[model samples]
Target: MSGHGEAQPMKSRKSGPLRGVAEVPGDKSISHRSLIFGAMAVGETRITGLLEGQDVLDTAKAMRAFGATVTRLGEGAWTVNGVGVGGFREPEDVIDCGNSGTGVRLIMGTMATAPITATFTGDASLRKRPMGRVTDPLALFGARAYGRQGGRLPMTVVGAANPVPVRYALPVASAQVKSAVLLAGLNAPGETVVIEKEPTRDHSERMLLGFGARLSVEKTGEGHVITLTGQPELRPQTVAVPRDPSSAAFPVCAALIVEGSDITVPGVSQNLTRNGLYLTLVEMGAEIDFLNPREEGGEPVADLRVRFSGEMKGIEVPPERAPSMIDEYPVLSVVAAFATGKTVMRGVKELRVKESDRIDAMARGLEACGVRIEEDEDTLIVHGMGPGGVPGGATCATHIDHRIAMSFLVCGLAAKAEIAVDDGSPIQTSFPVFLPLMNGLGASLTAG
Candidate 1:
């Protein structure tokens, strides 16, 4: 595996507090959904501020393969002319989703209820992630999937000819799984219901409704109960995707941990389902506040004013909030190292099967940097070293995971010594301007 490509090492040195405005790109989840929904709509869908990340780009390509006329107009602007509901054409070639689990899983769900046969594959890191969670639920819609051992990638999905709607209770807090089933239900008859034991990001549900799909969401004792009516003529509409809070976490955390730093990240999605990390950080006494709370693209958003907080105290993150902040645990762990006391994250076993074994990767990397941590199958406990107490002479192993590489780079800012990572190229998957943005904020990151 090491010989497949030349390894690049990058190092980061201690820096003063990060200060400036961070205008992060659009939300990744929403960007992906916009393309998928646009492809299934009856007319042209125009989108602005779309995240031009590799993951979202892969979804755009998949939409084009399904006969949608996807066109890039300019920076952060795209248009998709749909083939209408139940009008997807059978692709003659494989659907390669690259390194995006979201792209593959959600696309698989969308194609499952149709009468098409498609094969899915991805990069080395994405292929290692589990697909069983998606395939198991999709089987209820009369779809058939066959994959390698352990439900790894390079799989073929045979869609349902006569699909049946299903009511599924999510075993884990995953927006991708929920979105997949919901997308599959668009071509099926009758109503499809999904119950979440814990709330995840609701971008899929909200965007479906925005595109004129018949979708409703209600809070129930069991969890969030979502219902979708099938075979509706989805009318396309213009979409303005908000800045991703998950991507915003990197710069926000860096500013909070670094000394004498103050920054503002504008137009961040503050959707209640996705602000759990910022809430946890505020509870830990970080100097974060919302400015100009407003609505955009039918979602709640805010401009976050973050400043350096040296007296952060760690706190237990409620397990119920996992779905809202699932993609942020890696950056949260980096921030935790600078806090006092212990930060405990529970009910996150799903982290084990992401692009990398996130729990193991974070635990090992933190330990290597002279911070203490304990982990199990579903929980991670970090004994924070307080502000500026981290001894960071270690070179962290990123294991080809983008978040891991970025997280370690954030840790090096307030650490006593410099920190290094095995590779930094994967950061382009989501935040391509990460290093330049951080460097502009006075971070000393160097490529070797």
Candidate 2:
């Protein structure tokens, strides 16, 4: 099982201007998919710029357990000798996905149509999360799942001996759920279709096409209808992952609030589905320039030049943009505290089911830092304290959420007093180099 060791309390203090280039880690979403898809291909698939965080690493381990020979060549380079689709071997031991909900959920779908039985578990934080979202759909393909009540982990999946294709319409907006159904569809016999009322991230669809799957997406009056012809001989290809915009959000947002800060983030994915935070920031009067926009790894990429602006004003984030920026609201809330007026985030009921109840977590933490906030089941309204208005002498509970940990740390860099997180260890799950990267950019962060 993956372990973060002990609680490492960390604090951040008001710092001077931050100026530098922040090359954040590879995209976490793409990293996990690369390993999974590679393992499903027929030949060796090589990947570069893969995120080496715990979540992606756990996915790599799970791929190996399913009979793929996944190896790290060095740094961010990896090679996977796939067992091909419908060829996964039953694992000899329990699959411990650690703190990764993405890893376990996607893997469950990948093996759902094969004639194998596998049990999955994770860390305390991941185990508390609901897995029913994925399992409920998998049942349509003749997969049987039995776990603790409420569909928690330490669960076993009995793959279907005679699996059939399914047509599932998303009950909610979730990339994880959408990806799982698409993966399971790869093993069933006919064309499997999935309908989404709202378009989620299309990484799975894009990657599946890149790997030579017969898939097509159509947009009708009822939303996006995705059809995948099941059981293709997936071809292996070299994958180069773009830098993560989600991980880049920390430094990009930190620069927006810290007076005199100027920083550039290079090669970050500007995928339309993932750039909602950037759009929202620009709407608030943030001085960010999208430089040298181009394509990389089948996705749009760009360089971001951000400068500290004291004139930012909050705006209501459209509810439709929620699926694209769900993982970013915590840090966006931090930026809101430094802007003028209220920044309202709606259609974010999904925030309540992430690594933690993010709405409650950020609300309490911001409130403790002397920032007025209002939140209900589906909305969060952060009344901005304006430039340098946050008086931040408080210790915020991390709740084992990586984004929550990094968001509060960024908050301290501009607050009047220091801000501390009760446990910073969770940051390793996604952005392992978060501290060094921010500190190198002149932010004041320390662990004790």
* RMSD values, in order shown: 1.8, 0.7
lDDT of 1 at 376: 98
The 10-residue segment with the lowest total lDDT in model 1? 1-10
Off by over 4 Å in 1: 1-7
Model 1 per-residue lDDT tens digits across residues 1-448:
1111456788998997788888888888899999999999988999999999888888999999989999999998999999887788888888988879899999999999989999999888888888998999899999999999999889999999999999999887889999999999899999999999888888898888888889888998998899999999999999998888988999999998899999999988889899999999999999988999999988899999999999999899998888888889998998999999999999888888888999999999999999999999999999999889999999999987889999999999889999999988777778878888889878899878
lDDT by residue for model 2 over 1-448, one digit each (tens)?
Answer: 5455799999999999999999999999999999999999999999999999999998999999999999999999999999999999999999998888889999999999999999999988888899999999999999999999999988999998889999999998888999999999999999999999998889999999999999999999999999999999999989999899999999999999999999999987788889899999999999999999999888999999999999999999999998889899999999999999999998898999888999999999999999999999999999999999999999999988999999999999999999999999989889999999999999999998
lDDT per model, in order? 0.90, 0.94
> CA shift at 178, candidate 2, in angstroms?
0.7
Candidate 1 TM-score, C-alpha based = 0.97
